[model samples]
Target chain A: MKKILLPVLILALVIQLFVPSYMIWQRYDVLKSGTEVKFDIGLFDPYDAFRGRYVSIRVEDAIATSFVRGRYGILEIDENGFAKISRVESEPPKEGLYLISSEENYFSFPHNRYYMEETLAPEAEKVIGASAEAYITVRIKNGKSVISGMYIGDVPIEEYLTE
Target chain B: MRKEKWLLDEIEKWQTEEIISPESAEILKTRYAPKKKINLLIVLFSIIGTLFVGMGVVLVGAHNLWYKLPIAARTAIGFLPLVASQVLVLYVYLKKRDSIAFCEGAAILNMAGVFSSVAIVGQIFHLPSDFTNYILLCGVLALPSMLILNAIAPLGIYFWTVLNGGLCFDSLWETPLSTALYVVGALFAIYNFRAENGRAVYVAWISVISGFILVWVTSLLEDFDVFISLFAYFALLGSASVLWERAGRSLEISGTAGTLIVMLFATYEGWWLSSIKSDITIAVLTLAFLALAIGILIKKQRVVPAALAAFAALLLRAIWALVGLNSEPFSVVFMIVANVILLAVGVYYIWAGARKVSLLYANVGMITVCTLIIMRFFDSEMSLGIRGVVFILLGIGFLGFNSYLVRMRKKAKEEK
Candidate 1:
């Protein structure tokens, strides 16, 4: 019983570690190789008891009038990395970077929010709103996007807030 | 020991009744007497202490301490409780294998560790997944601990997590993944029933409730016809009752109660009359199924009178639907008859339980009756004051009925 129990315990621990580790590794890979895109967004801060502090953001040109239910919104990115909905498609794009949104009316970007220190979250929210040019940098690969960083004009939000 | 005393008393009674010889009674007493009782207070305190410690760890993890630390420190802090809890569980499994209290406590702590670790990882990394994914991750991570320790606490938490995860998404039945979560929950409930002691009834209830929600969600899908969904739901109830009768008493009751409630809903004219074609199809199918159920019960020679009455009411409503009885007066009469039949079933359960001296059944019956009565009171056009007065009266009546039972039991004891 002892021999069997030890192996099972080790296996459980390994799997538990593997889940979060694998999630992080996947996001890291996307950041490493994915094309970078920037979008101007409206931001607001909210406190979640479970997930701590984060700022919710809405992309400026991500809304669609001709929206279809249960279809992914196809987004076209310009040279400057700003994106607009080209059309809503039932299937994901065959190649290149495109924003895939689950919601029809609004873009449900995976990287819609930036998590931060509980105290600093409100400051980030304020900075995003106060700055004339507030945009978020995201790395998109194979229809998956991860928030790389947030910027107030040319400066990173973290650097701007810290200074 | 209290158990031994009870056994001894039962043996003495049998002896007085000449059901067993004096020597046989002595042998029975000797065989059944308990030996070497463990201190229950120690076990209880140990469980309570572990639970509080586990809750404390979760609270501390949730309290934004991660923000105060550097990235590497935050990651290490997130993993610390998880690794520590795993080690504790392993120690308990190897060293205190026979101690249920210790194993259960350790497993609970392990579950909390799993939840906190996943939550912290998600928060720190800003994982873009929804609550459903987090809940599923926590449930999966805690499954081994639940099975290894034969712990019901972790299993119960897993069940609740799946349930709330479904609610969080507002598409528990609609989403294939959420539906899969419900299936996983049912499987866990079954596993808990088989592995844990004295937990079959609770697990059975959970299983039936989960299945009901699944079927209801399937019914809400756009392409699925309503009549077919209703038929499928009724069939599910019937199959569950017949198949799980041997599993435990609660499964049968859950199925029967679920069927009765659905039939009661079917009787509401507003539910069926609005969609005439679908309504007629459902009414016809319901009648056929109720008839089939009644026939089976009669053939088995186990026909319950209250069940028969409920079925009869449903049958009448079905007939009324066929005849297109849309008059307000006729609908009111139909509703009253159905409700009265349901009330009769509750009363019958109460009377039968009291007569048979089963407190659990009696309480179940009393609750059913009380719930029905309260629902009726609220459904009526009675004033708030009148509703309050009726509720007070019902409470007093319950007390009086309990007092009567106690008096009757005392009389039986004196006679004996």
Candidate 2:
């Protein structure tokens, strides 16, 4: 039991450290290299027991007219520079960005949650939600998407709020 | 300290009275040697300090104080405590292995670090509030550290985490892999667990009662009434309570709680009149629980637990019969009878407890009767003022009975 203890602890430590590091690296990579686009969205307050408070992202425009279960949604920048689901396919676009959805109708996007400081989130949501030009800035690479920031009329929402 | 002093005094008395030799008395004294207060204080402060530090970091992250910092920096800071605690646990493992306080302290810090690492990352990266995923990841990763460090704190935390995972995830993590993860956890616990270690065994039993997800695993049964299925699942747990010492306490409490729930449902008219078809699982579990309860009654001479188990079995039978026959043999009289039986069971517990001179049994009986009566407040048409009076009366009665039992126990001990 004594001999095996250190090796097992190290193994667990590596996995534990690896998970969060990998997550950070993955998001970091996406934000650094991926195509940045805005998506017209609204927010409603929601609470997570572990992650604390956040605004739940609600995409404004129609995500998809038709969704196939276990298919990927290929998104394209519309005329207004807001991302819209252009097509659903079995394979992700060879050169462009795509989002995977295993469950039909529910389009899987990593940018569906915008976390904020505990007391600041609900107030931020109220301000950002009322704006006509409210959008979520997301960076997408390969298939991974990271929420860069929430915005109103090209100004970061945090700039408009009282800290 | 007090216990050690008392034991030493008792040993001296035994020696003077010539109950044992000086050598034997010396050995007894050595076994109960007083633990140093300073060492205990150090351990407590270390644990409390670590907790505060961890919570402070997480709270800072929650407030987005690190928002201005590069994500890399926030991530780095997050991993710092985790790395430090990982090393701390290893140090305890190699040097302070004999110290339970050290092991527990390391375990607590290690868990806090693990949580903060993930939480800060989640905070920095705007990770969605997928608590199920976050907690399960923490629990699964932290599980091995508990076994490696040989600490009860982590074991307790692991069990609680598994329970939360089951409840919060709903049917999301109910896949084969999640169940397999829990099975592996139990196996690891068994590997580390000694049957004699009271805390290890207690946590193990609680984990089985919750981690196995006997109740939540029925996500596949869409056609079945969840309430009827609860009877089957709870019957399964109730039978497990009689696993002869493995689940003796945890299962008894859990099984009794389940029985109470089903008993409450049985008192309702819709439960009997409704056309809910309970499957064969109910019958099988009811029989199993009945057999186990009867066995316990015969072997241990414990009547209340067996009686509660028997009541659960009867509920299962009536529910199961709804499948084959449209006749509602269980009626309003059955409702009255169920309430009466609950009251009777509580009274029986008090009687049996007093007869055995066991305060645990008597107190359990007292609480049982009090709880049963208090539960009736919602349905009873008593005014708020009257209910307050009843509450006061029950409180006084409880204190009076408790004092009487304490006096009797003291007298019996003195006589002995």
Candidate 3:
């Protein structure tokens, strides 16, 4: 029993580690190669039991469009590097990253919120809110997107919030 | 120690009565003698101390200290607790494998380290706050260690996390991930049962909770005929009660409670008067569940009178619907009959438990009787004076019934 159990435990552990590592690695790969887009965001802080404290972000462009359930919306970036929904599409776009919304109009963007320390999350929120310009930088590749960082007028929000 | 003393006294009495030979008595005494045991105080302190230290590490990580440190140093800091916990568990496994306190303490610390590491890694990398993904990742990472360590606490935490993830993240009951999780939990439960580690109860609870969530999700997401979802919910509860009986007592208790609660919910007038089609479907399903409950009772030969009473009440309400009695007075009459039946079943359970010397059944029966009588006081439209009189009479009757059971028990013991 012991002989059989050890191998099985090792195998399960390998699989467990492989999943999260693979997901993180995939996001890393996207950030390394994908197109970067910025969107202005409104911030609020909420506490989740499992995910700790996070600053919830609302993308102005993603919220502007009326979305049908199970459909994708096309987003276009302007010269200022801010994005907005150009039109709602029934299928995935031919070349660009698109937003998919649920029946309740919740979109699964590359990043919805930034997780931080519980004590510091409110401070982050306050700093983001105080900034005249707050934008989220996302990297999109092959229809998948990963959030790189939050920026307050070109400086990472973490730098300002920490100081 | 109390049990040991009682056993010694019983052995002495048996020897005096010549129930066993002198040699047999000596063997019994030797077998019943308590063995040297680990100090429970030490075990308690060790567990508590490890938990506090683990929480401290998590708090340090939560402070975003990783941001200030160099990449190499931050990586080491993030992974240090996890590696330390692993080393501790390995040492315990190799050197103190026979010590339950050391083994469990190391295992608990390892579990905590796993969660803290995941949270730290997520925070440092600025991962999105997708609870479903986070919980699934945690469960996968923790489950293997839990199995290896035979740790029940982490296993229970993982199960509840899966449950919350499914309820919060999944929409329209189309959560294939939750379904997969339920299957995983059931498999783990079976594995624990085979291992005989007494941790199967946690897994069984997970299965029950996940099963209920699945039913709720299905009810909400599917566009079904009116009573079909209701029937399906009851069927799920009935099947769970019958199927998971071997899991543990907790599952059995939960199953019974779930059945009763759903049945009580169904007794609302809206359920019966929704439509003729709905009324007919509810009536048929009630009869089916009643038959199933009776079959279970007969096979088990256990006095689960609460389940029986619930099924019977649902059946009565269905029968009332069939009779086309949609009047307010008729509904009141049906409620009264249901309460009376509940009271009678409770009394029967109390009597049966006393006869068999089973305290759990008797206590449940007593609570049921009290609850039903109190419900009547609120549910009925009787005058205040009449209701007060009814309450007093019922209280006296309950006292008399309890005294009767006590006397009966005494007589039985004396006869023995």
- Write the residue-wise lDDT of candidate 3 on A1-163 in tens digits: 8777666766655564455456557767777898888888888998755346778887776444333343565778889877776766666788776755433343344456776666777997888777769888877776566777788888777676767
Candidate 3 lDDT tens digits, B53-122:
7777777667664465643465567667777877776677567777756866776777677667777667
Model 1 over residues B181-241: C-alpha lDDT tens digits? 6676677676655433445666676676666655454434333334334444444344434
Two-chain DockQ for each candidate model: 0.42, 0.45, 0.37
Model 3 chain B weakest 10-residue run by lDDT: B223-232
In DockQ terms, which candidate is top?
2
The order by descending TM-score is 2, 3, 1
lDDT of 3 at A145: 67
- lDDT per residue (tens digit) for residues B34-77 in model 2: 86443656655666776677666556555655555677787788
Off by over 4 Å in 2: A44-55, A64-70, A78-81, A102-105, A116-131, A151-163, B1-52, B154-157, B172-174, B183-270, B279-304, B311-326, B329-351, B359-416
User: Which lDDT tens digits does candidate 2 get at residues A1-163?
Assistant: 6677678778887888898888888889988998888888877887654455778887775654333443677888877768887767776678777866634445555456777767778897778767778888878787777788888787777666653
For residues A1-163, could you state the per-residue lDDT of candidate 1 as single tens digits?
7568668877987898788677667777777898888877887888655566788877776354334443565667888777666666667778656766746544455555677767788998877777768888888788776787788878887678878
